[model samples]
Target chain A: MAPKYKLTYFPIMGLAEPIRFILSYGKIEFEDNRFESDKWPSIKESMPFGQVPVLEIDGKKICQTIAICRYLAKQVGLAGDNDWENLQIDMAADTVTDIRTKIVSPNYETDEEKKQKKKAEVINETLPFLLPRLDNLVKQNGGYLANGKLSWADLYFVALIDLLKFMIGFDITKDYSNLSALKNKVLEIPAIKEWVAKRPKTER
Target chain B: MAPKYKLTYFPIMGLAEPIRFILSYGKIEFEDNRFESDKWPSIKESMPFGQVPVLEIDGKKICQTIAICRYLAKQVGLAGDNDWENLQIDMAADTVTDIRTKIVSPNYETDEEKKQKKKAEVINETLPFLLPRLDNLVKQNGGYLANGKLSWADLYFVALIDLLKFMIGFDITKDYSNLSALKNKVLEIPAIKEWVAKRPKTER
Candidate 1:
């Protein structure tokens, strides 16, 4: 029997989307539990760390999106077979995460000057730094982040690039041909395409 | 033959310590490469995303410390064998990462007022949020972050608390009894103790 999994989030793709996509791609049946903003205070108390994107396995609740995604990746055999490959996948995903946290996570800055400054820094400093590196790695690894096969890291990169486009109103791969090609390839995966097509129509 | 792994970082253990610790604990041989201040620019150029703590595996370099640690954890059999356990471990490690990024990362602010304000928020908002939750989980899981065994998450937590002490000159775990106890237990691990005792000294 498939183990019961319940993912609790704020109806936003912010953190929970990757896990949701992974589970959907894997065809795993689980609950996409979203809570209203007003209900967050009460919900937050029940959460392990007062944060959402918690995955309830059987009855045990798990916190953190990467953990949940990685767990699901393992369950669905999306992670590579050996430790080295698994670590490579993790490293790729985490690189995307680093860029997100540093450049995108400060969305709460309402000041125009600060926001623009940050955006510029991201484009001028962060994007240039990461795009070329990813391109080189993709080329070297035969176009995959790990094991020369599609892994969670590849999907994560797609999601990350998609996120940057969504948030920044620009395509990161515009400058990096390999990344652009990789993103397109990942999006074309039958499971991923199907998941995206049928994904809940909501914005975080 | 064992694959060669090269880790490049500043002399301090700010971010790369956990990766180094895991590799050491696993008895995995890798180059503990450090950078002179003068060499940062050239070294930084080689890093994916222009960051430190890059891990070169079999001549392929990977970035992101959490990703590297997770990879090493898998190699050492420190991460759980199954999806559920791995997710739990990931969550624990990520939670610690969140606190570090949100609260501790801002501590580098040069502005004295802003620094103090961020530190206060960390003490008042972040610590309260994380410490109790971690304590509860530790108690619930019989003192381990996952699988009732020493995990990468446990080591991460230990490292986090140690970093907080280093940053603020105050022992955060002292208030959270469970956290303090857990830290002590992690410190007692023979490998960790030996590593700490023999770790190259730096004043960052």
Candidate 2:
């Protein structure tokens, strides 16, 4: 018999980190299948959507990061106990993704001038407009991203914050007390702490 | 008592159309609170995440379009029957959103040269890269976006296709038979047909 779960992703965390965090938090065993970048082309056609971060469950493949995180979340008890709460958690998680998307593309720009200009806009405009709102949301939600309790959304945030800080070139949580505390609270989890210390160190 | 659900959004069917489609499909009653664009600044302060398409349930508000759509999808009997099914549905739905996100921003570009360049790339590269895969998925899934059934993801795609067509300046389904069938199948639903026929018309 095979493992109950198999995660197919690049060696670095990137989009797959939340799913990894959730799996780690649950202490569930899995085959973490990380392959080299050059191997992607040969593998792309096998993917359901030609995307990395595909999670295989019981030999059936599922694509999309949040979709995989959400499916595993229910199994790990990180999901909400009810529909409304789940809605809140999903909403908060998607908002965090929205903020991340706004800043991530700049790193991929080939033009140096375009990349720096985009970085300036991110540092000056995008981060200022978005982070304060997220910070206040954490303040209102009692340091969790939703329902005033620990959920997978916080895990998702902590996992992505590394990639985000690398992209934006600073600790995104530095200016906001609530966000900083939220980051601390998530990292304090023994599972996450252990994983963070041991997971591959990537510049991304 | 207040309505069981109240959707706050702009008058146009941009982010909020799928939620509206789900609501109408379910025959669920709610206040369709469409407001003027100028009023957004005032209303923005009260919104969760300062975003529209907020679905209020029993006086509490939830933000994020897909989150609201998923919540209402369950109520409308359009959600997946199991966790695996839901995962498949969500993956497909998010893929639809991923494509939408890729092509939406160019329409808002202030510079005509950049806007046209982005449009050319979308028409030349993005559409060619993405739409056919989706076309094949619909074919493989039996005219549905996921789970080989008519889930709300199908409805979500149908609601979005019109806007995507407008943005791309052509009928996106023109070259893809399965995708064309999926669009027609979704539109032919009595509730959605009625909604589309009667809903406020907009350029977007």
Candidate 3:
């Protein structure tokens, strides 16, 4: 029997979108459960680790967004065929995550001036330092993030790029031709395209 | 022929110790290359992502400390037996990483006052809220991190707790009995015992 899958997350494309994209790409059926911010406090205690992007498989709950994405990616055959390849994909995914953290860190700052300063640092210093490396990697790896083929890292990056742009008020791939091309390639996947078109719009 | 393993990191166990522990646990021979801080700038360019805790297998380099640890754990027979089990372990490892991040973030603050404030919050509110949940997990999982037996998450948490205590100035496991027990169990492993007794000490 097919396993029953249900995902609970806030109604945002922040962390859960990659899991949603992977499941959709695999044509797997899952409950796309999204809750509002106001409803979260009451429901938070029921979540594992009091966090969302909790995936329920066969009625057992698993927390951690990346872990869930990795699991679903493996189940859907999007993971690497071997441990070495998985490591490469994991490295790429972590690189994308590192960039995301840099952009998102200042958003938590209560001081408006400091937040603006950090945002400038992210835009001017960090992005220039980080994105080119990623762009070069994609170019060298034949347009995929790792192992010269499509993997969950590709999906994860594209989904997060949308949020990054929304958060930082800039198109992240404007200067990186390779990342732009990679994002287009991922979005061209029929299932991904369908999901992107139909999924709820998020502000970041 | 056995694949050659080489780990490169700073002379600190902040993030790389779990990889070292896994390699030791597996009895795998690898080059344990540690460098002083002053030498990093000159050597940073050659690294995959300009980060430490890189594992060079054969000749190829893999970056991201957690990714390296995950790969080494698998090689050492410490990973989960199957995909779902791997997911469970990954979730636990990520949870530990989250807690570590909450503690480490303040250590980088340039403003001394803010750093102390953040550290206070981490100890007063965060630890109290987080550690009990982890304590219950350890208890519920039959004294190990995941799947009721030793896994990478157990090693990861145990290795990080030392750094956590050194950073926050508290033995985190003091109130969490199961966590303290888990630490004892991990430390009792003969290979880990050998590694920890001789590993270089760092001030968090």
Candidate 4:
């Protein structure tokens, strides 16, 4: 019997959107289960680690967004075939996730002064740190993160750049031409383009 | 020729210890490179993401501790044989990692205050969320994280529990008896036991 897959996450796109995008791009069928804020307490109790974005495979629960994404990516043959390429893809995706978790996840003060301070740190410290590295890697690896082919890491990078623009109101790829080119390249993929165009509109 | 591996990080365990532990337990030889504060600037520039704990394999650099550990784990067959089990192990390990990253990674005012806050949050949020779920999984699976066999996730839990105790200066597992037993059982693995005894002491 085919395993039944269902994803549980908040309505926001913060962590769950990438997984949704991956499944959509792969043309895999799954349920996108969103929970209301008020309904989270009781629902949260049943989750491992009390976290959402858990993927239920045939009624068995699996937690961690990256792990679930990678699992599905492997099933869809989006993860690179060889060990070396897979490692590179994992590294790129995980690096982006780490930066997002640290600088982009926290919502601090609403005051302009504090927001600007946080934005400045992101632009100066994190953006500068990540963009050039990714640019160089793309240049070195012939424009793809792994296998010089469209891997999940490429989609992850596109999602990350999109989120950065949304959160900070800044264009990271504008300065990094290579990354801009890479993003355009990824969007050119038929499945990904379709997924993006038809993706559910949710506030991140 | 066997590819040479070099790891660069600060002296503290923070993110580097897991990679170190996995390599040591797997009996894979690698250069353990530590950097002093003064040397960080030069070393940091060389890192792909300006972060420590980058792994150099065959002179090629890879960033992200989780990615590196996953790569190493796969090489030593520590991840798991099948895709499903591998996903489960990765998910569990990453879930624990998320909690640590959120609650314990901050530079709190002092050890006392940090411990107090961590203890409260662990009891309230983390313990209730993770302990029973993991315990149930272990009980059902016959003690290991996946496929009824030891995996890197099993070892990761051991490291995580030890870190919690080290950080809070209290026995956390006392409350979760199954977790306490799981930790003890993980420690009994011969390779892990030897590695634990010889593991370099660090302020994790």
Q: Per-residue lDDT for A139-204 in model 2, tens only?
A: 898888888999999999888987888778888889999888988988989988888898888876
DockQ of all predictions against the true structure, Cα-based = 0.77, 0.77, 0.82, 0.75
lDDT of each: 0.78, 0.87, 0.89, 0.76
> Which residue pairs in candidate 1 have backbone atoms (N, alpha carbon, C) closer than 3 angstroms, thus clashing?
none
Ranking according to TM-score, highest score first: 3, 2, 1, 4
Q: Which residue pairs clash within candidate 2?
A: none
- Tens-place lDDT digits, model 1, residues B1-204: 888999888888778888877887887888989888799888877666788888888887778788788777877878787776777788878888876766565564545776787778778888888878878778877888777888998887676565667876677778877778888998888888888898887643
- lDDT (Cα, tens digit) per residue for candidate 3, span A174-194: 899999999999999999999
Candidate No. with top TM-score: 3
User: Which is the better candidate, 3 or 4, if ranked by DockQ?
Assistant: 3
> Which run of 10 residues does model 3 chain A get worst, by summed lDDT?
A42-51
Best by lDDT: 3
Give the Å shift of residue B109 in candidate 3. 2.8
Query: Residues B1-204, candidate 4, lDDT per residue (tens digit)?
Result: 878999888876667777877887788898988887899999988788888789999998888878888889988878878788888788878876765664464333235565566567765766666667767777766777667787887777676665666665565567666667777987787777787787677756
Off by over 4 Å in 4: A108-116, B105-124
Q: Fnat for model 2?
A: 0.75
Give each model a TM-score: 0.91, 0.94, 0.97, 0.89
Give one clash count per candidate, in the order shown: 0, 0, 0, 0
For model 4, residues A41-139, the per-residue Cα lDDT tens digits are 998878877788888998988888889888888877789888888898998788778667655633433346655776677777777777788788888
- Candidate 2 vs candidate 4, TM-score winner: 2
Q: What docking grade does candidate 1 earn?
A: medium
